[model samples]
Target: MIENLWLIGIGTGSPLHVTGEGMQALRDAAVILVPTKGAGKDDLAALRHAIVTASGTYAKVIAFEYPVRDPSLPYIERVTAWHDEIALRWQHALKDAIVGGPVALLVWGDPSLYDSTMRIAERLDPLPKIRIVPGITAIQALTAAHAIPLNTLGGPVQITTGRQLRAQGWPSRAETVVVMLDSECSFRTLDPEGLLIWWGAFLGMEEQVLFHGPLAEAADQIEAIRQTARAEHGWIMDTYLLRRT
Candidate 1:
């Protein structure tokens, strides 16, 4: 039988953000696979290690370098190929670490939101029974940091990516849009006449930055700050909320 795979959401690099259930999941894991993007991105893996160490889970923690996607390929194809590579990595790591037992991965934010770990896990040859221990998401972190509600009154909200905003423009029927994995600040491509934006980086962390204003006014500052932060940290994960005013 395939071992159980636990996709545990750890939440925004804050130990306090981990749920009790998530901690228990970590404690129960026989092996935990942590992915590092490279030298400059070691903090991502370190944060996972910190949590595991603090939890006193006693699980064998193994760190592996994450495979990079080829940007020249079509976006979907590139992502699919990357996921396949990641699944292979997971299998290799599990084989070396766990004899035949439950394994866990500490996913940033909630695994369901813009996270492909679940999809990659599904590709395992003998699929393991999957369990998701959800944690706080960056969206929730952003809204809480800014003291704003995600939706106005009873209005609807759409969650999307930077690429979609650049290609399709503002979604016609939605009043609010939450954009994630955006490096381009694609809201600048839209007609800012009736739009208000709330952008946040490093949400729920001490280094969090938030800017809220008319899209036109905040776009430049957001871009500048984003560039500076990315250069300083060597990587960034930012999300923004746009509302039609």
Candidate 2:
């Protein structure tokens, strides 16, 4: 029986973003599962490996291949099946890696925000006790790196995804909306009038990039830079906050 299953948030990209609590969690686990999305995107896997090595944890580190989500299937359906496969992979890796762990899986950003590690873990049979060590989220990093406050003077803030923004224009409720998991620059679809945007790619890493201005003026530039970065690095993780002026 497993004692603890820790989903440690190691922040967006920077190893420095690993929290002390998360580091301790790594040290405690017997097996550390680091996942790779195959080729062209091994940087993430490397970063996860670096965290484990830097933590001085002699615990067995297991590197597993992540299941690629089929874009043809409906988004909901694809994600459901993908999670199931991922859970199965974790089960096999944990079983082979060792017995009775306190296993740790380093999650990107905070598991609470737009992450599915916990959801996938729930699918495992004979579930183990769970512990979460939250790290900095992309939005927090974005605001911090750019030196901007998340909310404007007691104003409401809503966190959402690019799909929602594209599906239903700007949200009618919140003065500020932070969008994540957006490969598409959905802000271009909205009326950029009176809207200010702060965008960042690679959040806290060395290749980090930041851009901000009126959405109308900066949207194109952002798209171009994002495309170039993705082409260069083979993958890019980004988030942005749009504030109504």
Candidate 3:
């Protein structure tokens, strides 16, 4: 039988942001898996290392290169195949290192949000007992960095992706919408009249950027900064929230 598997949320790569329960989970793990996204994105892996080092709670940390999905395939098919490969990678890594013991993965932000760690964890052959330790998410970090509440008084908020917003336009009944995983400036497709947008990139990091104004006025600036940042870093994960006035 498989041992315990802890999916610990690390919260925006900041060791200070790790919760007490998450720290305990890390201490309990026999092996910790760190995923590398190749060279240009080595910083992503480095951030995890920094967290581990700062915590001073030594575990048998191992790094493995993450499997890249084929972009040419249909989105759903591509994701499914990618998850399968990742699961296989995890199995191989676990078998080679830890035998049967508690393993931990430092997830960026809260795994319960848009992350796929839970789905992939379920695909394990002999599923291990799973435990989730929640952490601050990008949305939370963004709002906190900007010093604004996530929702208006008595107003509901919708969280969605760039593709959905681009294809379907504003949600029928949502007063506030938070968008993530958007490569394109999907907000450009909106009418932009009387809409307010708060955009942030590299949230909680030293190089973080924040901009907010009427959608029409701030849209271009957001696009420019996003493009420049992507070019500089070769990858960027950003999120934004839109509120209609």
Candidate 2: regions farther than 4 A off: 1-3
- Candidate 2 lDDT for residue 43: 83
Could you tell me which residue pairs clash in candidate 2?
none
By TM-score, the better pick of 1 and 2 is 2
Stretches of candidate 3 above 4 Å error?
A: none
Q: Highest lDDT among the candidates is held by which one? A: 2
Q: How would you encode candidate 3's per-residue C-alpha lDDT over 21-138 as one tens digit per residue?
A: 8888777777888999986788889888887776666688888779999999999999999999998888877665744468889999999999999999999968888999998899
TM-score of each: 0.97, 0.97, 0.97
Error of 2 at 87 (Å): 0.3
Candidate 1, residue 150: lDDT: 95
| Local accuracy of candidate 2 as per-residue lDDT tens digits, 147-211 | 99999999999999999989988888899999998888999889999999999999989999999
Residue 159 miss distance in model 3 (angstroms): 0.5
Query: 29 in model 3: Cα distance from truth in Å?
Result: 0.8
For residues 67-144, what per-residue lDDT tens digits would candidate 1 score against the true structure? Answer: 999999998999999999999888777564534577889999999999999999899989889999999999999898
Which candidate has the highest TM-score of all?
2
| Cα-based lDDT for every prediction | 0.88, 0.90, 0.88
